[model samples]
Target: MPGNLKDRRGAGRHPAEALTCFCRDVLTSLGVPDEDAAVVADSLVRANLEGKDSHGISRLPIYAKRIRECRISARPDICIDRDGAVLKVDGGNGLGQVVSYKALQAAFPVARETGIAAVAVRNSNHFGAASYYCQMACREGMALIATTNSPPGIAPWGGKRAYLGTNPVAFGFPTRREPPVIVDMSSSIVARGKIILAAAEGREIPQDWAIDEEGLPTTDAEAALRGAVLPLGGPKGYALAVAVEMLSGVLSGAAFGPHVNNLYKDGDPPANVGHSFILIDVEHLMPLEEYYARLERFIREMKSHPKARGTEEILYPGERSYRTYMNRLREGVTLNPSLKSMLNDIGRACGVNL
Candidate 1:
């Protein structure tokens, strides 16, 4: 990051100032309601601070364009229907992050009462990282799992054509001695948003990450963008992604695969997507203290285990992000040149230059 910030040819703004500026300037330009815009801005900033560059500030241009086109609603009316332990929502085409946050607020009470609760959200835009919402329940000592479907980018097993979403999934649970165990991953070998960022930055992709139209692995970013992302563990990952599609898309009655809207594609309707979240009150299953105590012991054993040859330690799933969060918050986040330029353009258009 030392030399990265010194790379003057790229995004050349301090991370905090850039993120704050982007959130305030771009969301307002899109005509998002002041309250909802605040929520979206906060979530996007957190993504950057957490070191998830793919889901962070890079999305402002696409989202701003969608708003200008009037495809996505600026102030969608979020609705919820309760069905015992489950709640269904129609986002009214609002920003998915805000809609999902509203849904989670409803689910938290239900989970506390019934021991568990599930929320299904349909007719929404990209929600960014699912963990941003799941961490809510984790903070309340609840175990949480969340997922969302996306545009066609992954291929189903036994077929070459893309027919599934990268389908990001996330989970988080309380731990007494460490940061909450929050892990988010896409079912694909690499996240589609990551590829988009790479393409925006004019970088070459690895051959194993995706395949071209002919179904052959490639190192070309343009080819990979038009092709399908490989699965994480072959069929198992494909199956898992489909499961997410069913739970988030079909279960919520939202579109999936090609039916889902592509943020990069203009002249297209919102693809009217959907997503789902699950919350489990750990105290209902087991006492909260006991649950976390056992987790702490488990993490310590794994960390102190003998190293494999030159390896230092067997790091946990989310340990790296907590480290990144601490450092980035102090050192500031990095933005590529293209991303910075887009931010300036958005600022100028919005009449709120940074």
Candidate 2:
């Protein structure tokens, strides 16, 4: 975060396709198989297009660092154990996106047969975005609830020290005549990745987002990174985060809370992050057309309601992100100069120019 690297011009747009190619090539150079590399690359670039910049290609540098350190196995021997409609997966300390993608694929047929299915994954690293998997489920005509435990970045309610992650939970519900409703959110007021991105961009955060080491609020991104992020709504968010830990970490038999290793700080130990997914096959529950009709009617009613002052229009959970994705796909994603510089540096290390 040196002053010289900060670009005052804000950000510059870049083609998503080019970024995906660069990300895939870099991972492949690090010994990741081409197919898996492409999966990770597509997920990262999709985040950028969806306006989730915190989980975008800006993360490739850290992933590359972990791969080189041997903390993340480039060719992990992922193992899956199934019991009826339930699945238990061991990721073998692999990239999270790859592990999660495989887990979802394994759940598809089981859910179709049983009406619902659950997949618990362990020994995974940072997954770019929870919504990515949720969207995949939607494409399979399923409703999915997905959650993941991350390295600690938040404290328990009324506590001063970091003890819980800003664990994210996502829900994807398919609808007729509308984009899938995807509600993807962190238990914290904001995701910790945003603070990391802000620090890398030499920008200050909103004071309410996180606290300093002394448990006081701070606008400094660096200080926030050193401390704990604030939960979404005090006790409620704290409880939600704990629930996510139980579902993703405890149930999956993976690292929970403080046990998860820091993605950047702990280079030697593999981050034993965990993820859980619940998939419900719409056709099995009710006729797909009937379910879609009900959902569309509900959305129409919700959107027709009167809006509060300053509100332009009501939007569904994933509507804005879907719009952003379309616009960015047609145009391009805007990358801050610092991010570009970091990506270029990673490219240089991998002997691939961005």
Candidate 3:
């Protein structure tokens, strides 16, 4: 919690499974099939477990609304078009988690055979986090590079108006002796969902996160939503965002930049957002055991290096998220009052008791 959100928030904890069930029930009631709803629910809950609350259960209400408004299809006939190591997925305007998960699953066998495979998805709604898909690849002893484009929320470097998404890029690699290495980040300084969450909780954002409509930095979350999110590393981030747009949007033949509909605000027409995934089978390159040993050695040497002032032990990219997931699994996920209330309302509307 930040700013006034700390005072206004409620303290409530629930088992992750229970929350998942609640989410599934709501989606199913909205005409989504049981399996599809489960995939979507699990993705959201996993985000919470991984300490990425911005991509977590807070999105349920909006998802339900979109489904109800026919902006997102409840029962989609996802189709695939494959060409050797390349695959194209048409989500049929379905829930992103369900659509993207299917695309990744379809890529795995191709990657295993070809050593490398790529999947491009179009007509998908907002999927939770890129880490989820990358982690899936890691579990199969593969490395993955994933990226997705969203509605315009970030400006190009040196520009004042938004023309690019807070596009996210993620990487994941398997390790035998430790948690998989994962690096997931948005091109913007922070995700747009963080500002939305802050606004929902009546909190203020950090000034550097975004600019107001007048192009001045602001700490107000609402103003940030109305304006644009700043790029993560100025020109560097803008460059990355452009690359992501090319791969996920242009190459996939999906709506790019301002053409992509806003998932949270817009209802008319579908959100033709796009995503791209590249999978490499690590074992295909070298002996799996030998590669693991080398990776472990690298990790050990890095950790053995001197620490910065006041810093504790060095941790790998995904270590913190793995620890958080384990802790939350045991201790349960905490839900703020506002979020809890929204879920409750959704439950009532769906005739499900939470």
Candidate 4:
């Protein structure tokens, strides 16, 4: 393992609940309502627990700064407009986490009645992860397909300059197991936030992740940030990104491509990110018990199929995250030196103690 990776592995860890409390305190102090702040904090902390540190508390400072600048509404007046099984949500420029949660909440009842429902959200910020909303729907016995558009970070395939965001698509299905089966992936080889996290820690990224502005592959995190993240499967990933942008950005009537403001850039306009969600009542397709039984059997067969040389076991989508979440709940979540210092600075600035 790299020295930086080893060091991070040995870094100080904090209990998940404590970190969530700290995040909530910081947001609440910045004029966010208690409920909204808790929702955001829980989403961040859950990301940490699931081992997605890039989208965890590391983003709190930026969120706080945006809230203070009035770029993100502290108390947004979210509005939902319904058209049969389709719903349109105007986030009122509220925090993405809160707005997405509310949008999903509004879709569930309609989905239950209509068998399937879709919600399109506009004027929202960056929601932590698409999987979070999908999983929420899964827990309610609904299968969910979710997608979102972000600030420009990845270039369209065959191009050098950025024109498309590292859009993501996620899905979740309830199973007989505790954690629902979930898959979440960005169209890029890696999520843009991971690159930003590496830059913050002064760690180098893999050379294949991104290319410098000059269209040369670089491992330097700072240089990569100035460049564009590469698509996951070449043209296929690029195509998927465009599809997500159409559904999330154009369909939702939110800013698309370069029009979306950069979330990390300080003086920019509000990040008018967009998200789209589709919920299907699984019970409508088959009996819940039969569906769960068949899914479990399929998972079992896949896991037992075979293991290649040097492989420990076969794991399915969301299985690794489920294990990480369980382990973190008991062993606590680790924070590297840089992240710890950043959190401390945020706490000091906000008159909160971590």
Best by lDDT: 2
- Report how far residue 136 has shifted in candidate 2, in Å: 0.1
Residue pairs with backbone overlap in model 2: none
Q: What is the C-alpha lDDT of each candidate?
A: 0.83, 0.93, 0.92, 0.92
| Candidate 1: tens digits of C-alpha lDDT, residues 1-354 | 346654532355465655765686678767787777877887787788888888887787777778787787887888899999999999998887888888998899999999999888899989988778866777888888999999988888866778898998999877776778888999999889888888888899888999888888988888887888998899988998999999989889999778997878867787677888889999998887788778999898989998989997688877788788777777777777788888888888888765
| Model 3 C-alpha lDDT per residue in residues 87-146, reported as the tens digit of each score | 999999999999999999999999999999999999998999999998899999999999
Residues 1-354, model 2: lDDT tens digits: 223222521247677887899999999999999999999999999999999999999899999999998989999999999999999999999999999999999999999999999999999989899999988999898999999999999999888788999999999998766899999999999999999999998899999999999999999999999899999999999999999999999999999999999888964489999999999999997899999989988999999989999999999899999999999886778887888898999999999988
**Structural similarity to truth (TM-score) of each candidate:** 0.94, 0.96, 0.96, 0.96
Judge candidate 4 against the unseen true structure and give its global Cα lDDT, from 0 to 1.
Answer: 0.92
TM-score of 1: 0.94
lDDT for model 1: 0.83
Which regions of candidate 1 are displaced past 4 Å? 1-13
Q: How many backbone clashes does candidate 3 have?
A: 0
